[model samples]
Target: MIFFYIFLLLFPHQICQAEVNSNMEGKLLNDLLKDYNKMSRPVKNLSSPLEVTINIGTFESFDLDEISQTISVLLYITVSWVDKFLTWNPEEYSGINQTRLPAGQIWIPDLQLQHTPIGSGMLSTESNAILDSSGLVKHTPPGTIKTICQEMDLYKFPYDTQTCTIEHLSFTHPSNELFLRLGDFTLDQNTFQSQEWQLLNVTSRIEINYYGGPYPFQKHIICLMVKRIPNYYISNMIYPYAVLASVAGLGFTLPPDSADKLSLGVSVLLSTTFYAGMVADIVPVTTSMPFLGLYCLVMMSLVAFSVVSTLAVINLHNRGEAKMSYLQKTIFLKFLPSLLFMEKKSKPSQVQRNTNHKGKVQVETLNDSSKEVEQEQAKDWKFAAKVLNEFCMIIFSAGFFIIFAYTIFFL
Candidate 1:
């Protein structure tokens, strides 16, 4: 019963105090806006332009559409200027030194992107701004900005860096009427990280409009330097092609006498073609080819070539005795085989003398007209086929390493 009486006694006192505080704020607001013109410029001196300092607080969402060549950013920016006409005495208004008001009630500069569509304004509308008794007005407006950027360089994609730009310019006002300056750009640590792209650095500057004509329009440009995070592409696209190419190259080392050599080449070739198709579906459709796409296409072609080379090797292996040309003998049979550490097989010699039955001595002579000479020719043909197989292995191996190495380190 005592606590209920105490609550009843405090209710009227609380209502009276609330009413007094409300009246004080009401009088302060009314006195500040008395005879004030919202549309008029806040400049007390007509000899100089009003200087507005804009500070970029943070960037939340950064999206770069490479296909469209545009960058869209969500900006949290604060613009502040001294409004000379909005000043008031804080002591007369119950020490109310600060207040909030809708931004549409005051005069704000008209801003638009330099590369955006004409007549499309960029400023946010009707947001609340904090006003101080000393005539300082600060407005933080959240807005989405989409602007054209430089052409994306995709030749070194998966290891490429792109520079994109966004410029905010004064649309309706010239440099003499309203001066604009950039304060600083702060990148929050959590928001700067992207899954596919990493923020490398940022640069900002103020430049005069090139198409401003005789009137000078000012612009604040912020350029973002971002690099591609290549881990995803390496795992999904490049690494698999490398492993598939190794499988195809091994077909050249397979023995030509068996069907497994042809089978392996055909299977790997088909697999490469299918995999390349999958990669093409996911990659951006562009007139010029990206480095990764080009690498994949070349790998598919090499796999197909391996299949053809294996067929020729199989055909060359199953041949009968035939004479080799001078070029074939000197180059394929001797010099090239020696470079591959393959020496030509020596011709077998027939027994010159033999003992006959009953322990009696008998003589037999070897001659060039003997049947062994034809057998030796057959052996030479087979040896030459072995040399060609080794040669193809080297060629396929060289091709794989050269393209893969360049893609990894250089491109």
Candidate 2:
């Protein structure tokens, strides 16, 4: 009986020892699984050292207004990825440790990504995704993967920097507005709502390449889009037009008797005409009138006035008769003379008498010499007329050439 009891006690001890060994093994396996889960977690470290490259593609612009004040841009981006290094491996684990480890997986979750402009301007778009397209993967495990993100936004400026250059910027007179769309990892959809965005200044498209995996085992391509905002100066449509019209209006200030009137008027007219043609050449012809067109028309009217006034002055001098008619003697001679002397003279009697006699002599001399002076003035006027005619011819020729060249080349 003592022998049987000893046997039973030894068997219980062995069973207990076996259970303790099993428990220890379970604990070790659990620890290894915890480590694997920690290592396989996705993209928690953005600032981790990475190998990256970027390439940009063609950009296109669209006008949303008649004046070309508002515009939109389309851009293409291409990115390439290289080899990447991963730190932890599921294959390294053995036996029960493998079962305990969470499924070997890595994924980026809830990534708050944005393409920020380091230079200047605000993007005019909703922070949403529009199109997300990916290309085919080449290699097998831990291979190259490329991702494309697209977005549209409005931009405005006083640019903060001048480092990067964007191609195909469109602009027009009176308003300088711009539009653009860009993206990196996320896509923007229905972002072009008018009420949500204001005018923009500039736009940028960018591309980024990512290298990941065990020191050098994977590659990825990321595309980024950016748009810049600009501050705009708003004024009346008539302000610029009025300023140009006033340049032609200066011809009216010339004295009627001055021989330079015709030359001055013709010169002003030609210059204004050239400016008008320049404006016309740059803009498309439309049924609707432009502020610049209004300005040119106003200037032409003033030129017409100058031409008529010159003709009238010449006609009046050509009729060189000084025989004081009732109208001329009564109104011009008598009334004009009385008006000048109505105020008392601040001079001695002798000086006053001399002044009166001088006035009489001057009037008589004017009557005698009027025809000769008229003939001399007429010659000066004729020279002016010839100069004006020549100027008009030159202007016409220049305008014709400009029109012809524009049609042949630009049109």
Candidate 3:
């Protein structure tokens, strides 16, 4: 019985409270909207400009199109401005401090994107604007922003960092009536929405533009800095090319008479050509060559030279076992062998040995025929060809390394 009595007592109080709350909200809305003009700007003075602030809360989605040189982002945007005509006394209506109203019925800032081709850069969509008793209106609007970033720095290509900016300019209103600026545009941890790009930072700045208005207009510039993840290029393009270069260098170690030496270099050269075209297709047409592209070109050149050197070495080795000239003996036989850490084996001595046949004292002086001496001093093209192959290997390998380092650092 006590519980039943308590319920009956609270029921009437709850009903009265609900009616009071409803009446308070309805009366507040009615009083505020009675004289509100949605088409006119909320500023009371014509000379005082209405300061509007737009802040990027978060990026729901982000994408970059390399071919088109465009970037698309779906951002959670917050717009804030103070309406001088929307103010009221919070003490008059049950101490109500804030309320929400339809955003389409309020005066919104007229801002358009300078680089976008879509319909006017209106961020305000079907949403509610929170109105405080102090005349502060805060609206959170939704839209996908597409902007062109023409000056994309592709010098580094796959390992490149790109910064794209979206400019928001006031179209209809001059700086005297309305001005727009950026709030805290820092991105949160969830800003990384693109698989190929990493969001490093989001920055914004406001500048007064003087293009079309008697008064200077305000423009809010939003800069998004992102770095490309190079894992894909490293795995598919760079690693394979590095392996191919090593294989081509190993071809020098093969004997000049082996058929695989020249063929190996040719194969590597072909592979390098294919990879260079692949890298060219991966990046858009830019004003300057990418570092990786230059690297590929250098590798291609080195591989081609290696093939030519291998062919020459093979030809020299198989030139009918021809005898080497004096210059060839001096350079390839002596100097080159010393320079390339190769040592030539000498012919065995054919001097006669004294035989003690009858236990008689017999001594024989050493003597060598002219033909034997000439044969001992003879050198062939085969050993010279081997030395040339070693020299080519060292040179081409060093060229590959030098070009790789130059492109990596000096692009």
Best lDDT among the predictions, by candidate number: 3
What's the count of clashing pairs in each model shown?
0, 33, 0
Model 2 per-residue lDDT tens digits across residues 1-411: 999888778798777767765775456445433434323222235344322222334333322222322223353333222212222233332222212111123111111123222222221222211111121111111211111122211111111111222331111100111111232432333333332133233334433222332222221223223332222211222233334434434444554457875676576667667766755663444455543454455555555555555555445434443333476445433453354332212322222222464465322223335565555545444433334333433443454344334322342
Off by over 4 Å in 2: 1-72, 75-253, 322-411
Candidate 3 vs. true structure, TM-score: 0.78
How big is the positional error of residue 151 in model 2, measured in Å on the Cα after superposition? 26
**Each model's C-alpha lDDT?**
0.79, 0.35, 0.81
Residue ranges of candidate 1 with Cα displaced over 4 Å: 1-47, 84-87, 91-93, 116-121, 278-289, 321-323, 351-378, 406-411
Superior candidate under lDDT, 2 versus 3:
3
Who is ahead in lDDT, 1 or 3?
3
Expressed as tens digits, the lDDT of each residue in 1-411 for candidate 1 is 999888868797877767876788788777777788887678977767888888877766777766667777776778888899888888877677888878887767676777864357567756988889999899887667778776777778778898988778876677887899888678775776467777887778888875636778888788888888889888888889999989988887667787799999888888888888877765566678988889998898888888888887776676665666798788767897889998875855565666777887766666667476667776777777788878877888888899899988886
RMSD of each: 3.8, 20.7, 5.2
Please, what are the lDDT tens digits per residue for candidate 3 over residues 108-187? 78777888867766766488899999999998886788999869988887788999998888777887888776686656
Steric clash count of candidate 3: 0
